[model samples]
Target: MVLERFDAIVFDWDGTLLDSTAAIAGAIRGAAADLGLPDPGPERAAQV
Candidate 1:
């Protein structure tokens, strides 16, 4: 009962244990800034 590609399963779909939206949004903003592009802002970043 083990998969070679994965070590564990995640069960945080409801954001009770973890919330990756902010982190992902920050990364997107950082990437855009790195490329000399305007920031999409927190609202746009989190939504789109």
Candidate 2:
């Protein structure tokens, strides 16, 4: 019903509607460490 009423729907949650930089950075760092890789640290991780 909702889809039929609207031709399209958009969601803006990619750091614009909501900021998840810290969480995303942490996940990246954790993944790297899980593989025995060096930690990029907060700075580098944020850049990524």
Candidate 3:
């Protein structure tokens, strides 16, 4: 099979390009808890 190349490629940021804000925040919180650190909430994580 041959692949076709397109001249223009449109991408979506918020939904398509892995906008996992909540997942990242949860993972950070879990990791912090595991390492005995404060639970940085979603807002804080996003800021960082």
Q: Name the candidate that leads on TM-score.
A: 2
RMSD of 1: 5.6
- Estimated TM-score for each candidate: 0.63, 0.76, 0.54
lDDT of every predicted structure (CA atoms) = 0.87, 0.90, 0.80
Ranking by TM-score: 2, 1, 3
What's the count of clashing pairs in each model shown? Answer: 0, 0, 0
Q: Which prediction has more favorable lDDT, 1 or 3?
A: 1
User: What pairs collide in candidate 1?
Assistant: none
Tens digits of lDDT, candidate 2, 6-36:
7779999887898888998999999999999
Query: How well does candidate 2 match the true structure in TM-score terms?
Result: 0.76
Between prediction 1 and prediction 2, which has the larger lDDT? 2
Candidate 1 regions exceeding 4 Å error are 1-16
In order, what is each prediction's RMSD in angstroms? 5.6, 3.3, 4.7
Instruction: Sort the candidates on lDDT, descending order.
Output: 2, 1, 3
Tell me model 2's lDDT, rounded to 2 decimals: 0.90
lDDT of 3: 0.80
